[model samples]
Target: MTEYILLAIIMVFIYFVLIRNKPAPKTDWEGLPTLPEYKEIEKTTTSEGELCCQYCGHTETIERSLNSEKENPNKNKFYHACTNCKVILWRSEQS
Candidate 1:
């Protein structure tokens, strides 16, 4: 009618701006394989002894200090070795 309603409003604004501005289909990450460098492994104490969590096997009896003889009010009894998941860590304010 008015030139077919101005060619259906310019084909509905070119189908909503160039087919909705299509650009989203590109993710290969080029093979994607490079993630392995978190090595701090030297854990040994499980012949029925306790203290385990080498990245979460999670056994635990902990709290050791049979007196290396330093009579103190609480030097926190020192059993520390967890610099990011090396896991020995038993000085929780001495109990």
Candidate 2:
């Protein structure tokens, strides 16, 4: 009787451990919506001008980098992010 009870308990423990330790399947990509294509702005320099998203026409705030000016004296570098569509417009020294 003791042996049978011990065997049953061990079997139940093993079953629970195996089933609970199984990893969840990857299915997040199936339900995700596709993102729209990124749009590139024609103009580079903001120069304290208002930035707007080309696709949604949402207004954006311009962020200027002083570090870029220190590195390259001739060129300017800045980024503008749209409030509504969250699009980023940037101008690098190379552009």
Candidate 3:
């Protein structure tokens, strides 16, 4: 019984250390509403802004345009992922 308990404990520790997930996988995609097509704003209220993660609720300010003109010319949408959660946030309309 003592050996079995020790083995169990070791197994649990290994599972947590090696197999445990440090960060949860991204599930926002296909769940949250997709961001609308980006539109270049001749005049935008907030040029530099931040996007808070829906899962962790962590806010990250990005200097890049809210809407990326390079990727989606017709629709200017900034594509970025959360450093912590690695989840894709929304691309505002240069706001």
Candidate 4:
């Protein structure tokens, strides 16, 4: 009777501890490829463009100063070139 009881207690302990669903082991990432911190952007685009040439009625090629804005209080603030005319289209500040 006592032997049966001891065996039953041992089985119950085994069922709760060793035989029960064990916790998943920690991952060993020694040789694994590391993931990027950010989801990389795949597309590239630009909003900057060339202004229409007023003289020749043609579009001019892109230059660094073509898409830039400047600040000047006294003289011309915004100046644009027109084709091969060599004339500056001076634009004033508009509210």
Candidate 5:
């Protein structure tokens, strides 16, 4: 009976040592909708300062917004986004 108890204690100790401190599995943020992508911005705005959105046809100089690339996260990759339709109008990348 004492040997059985010792074996049981050893087994429990091994279980805790092996299972308790295992590193968590890595996660890939591929399917997250909130995550942005580094791609082309279609239906971009005018370069002549027309203040127009080509996709939704929303025109307003004040409502235009500017944003950066998600992957780069720098001022080098700048783009204009429409406040009304939330679409990227124009993109400028500093070479």
Candidate 6:
């Protein structure tokens, strides 16, 4: 009975040390820092159908697609993101 009690105590110690003490998993969004204030210099369209940020000179393509479920199913949709800075310039779907 004393041996069983010793085993139980060992098991509880291992559980607390190895399993319960683990740190929480980090997420992708958590690592990204907030961007500072920056001015948008110019806007231009590329031949490949991408918007260019004149301030950072980063070119990013905005995705275009038709939403079949909407009333205007043929309406174009896309979100713009700077390739270099990874800043989201514009987003069509607010929600």
Among all candidates shown, the one with the greatest TM-score: 6
Decide which is better by TM-score, 3 or 5: 5
Candidate 2: global Cα-lDDT?
0.50
Question: How far out, in Å, is residue 66 in model 3?
Answer: 10
Counting clashing residue pairs in each candidate, in order, gives 0, 0, 1, 0, 2, 0
Decreasing lDDT order of the candidates: 6, 5, 3, 2, 1, 4
Judged by lDDT, which candidate is best? 6
CA shift of 43, model 4, Å: 28
lDDT of 2 by residue, 1-95 (tens): 99999999999999889987788764332222222222333332244454456556555545444354444465454444556776554433335
TM-score of each: 0.22, 0.28, 0.29, 0.25, 0.32, 0.35
Q: Of the pair 2 and 3, which is ahead by TM-score?
A: 3
Q: What overall lDDT goes with each candidate model?
A: 0.47, 0.50, 0.51, 0.41, 0.51, 0.52
Q: Which 10-residue span in candidate 2 carries the lowest summed lDDT? A: 29-38
Identify the runs in model 6 with alpha carbons over 4 angstroms from their true place.
31-58, 61-95
Comparing 2 and 4 by TM-score, which wins?
2
Model 5: how far residue 36 lies from native, Å:
24
The residue-by-residue lDDT of candidate 1 on 1-95, one tens digit each, is: 99999999999999988998787653322122211211223343345655454555455435444344544345544443434465443333354
RMSD of every candidate to native, in Å, equals: 18.3, 13.0, 12.8, 23.0, 10.1, 10.1
- Using TM-score as the yardstick, the better of models 3 and 6 is 6
Candidate 2 deviation (Cα RMSD):
13.0
Q: Give the clashing residue pairs of candidate 4, or none.
A: none
* TM-score, predicted candidate 4 vs. hidden true structure: 0.25
**Reference-based TM-score, model 6:** 0.35
Q: Candidate 5: TM-score? A: 0.32
Off by over 4 Å in 3: 1-51, 61-71
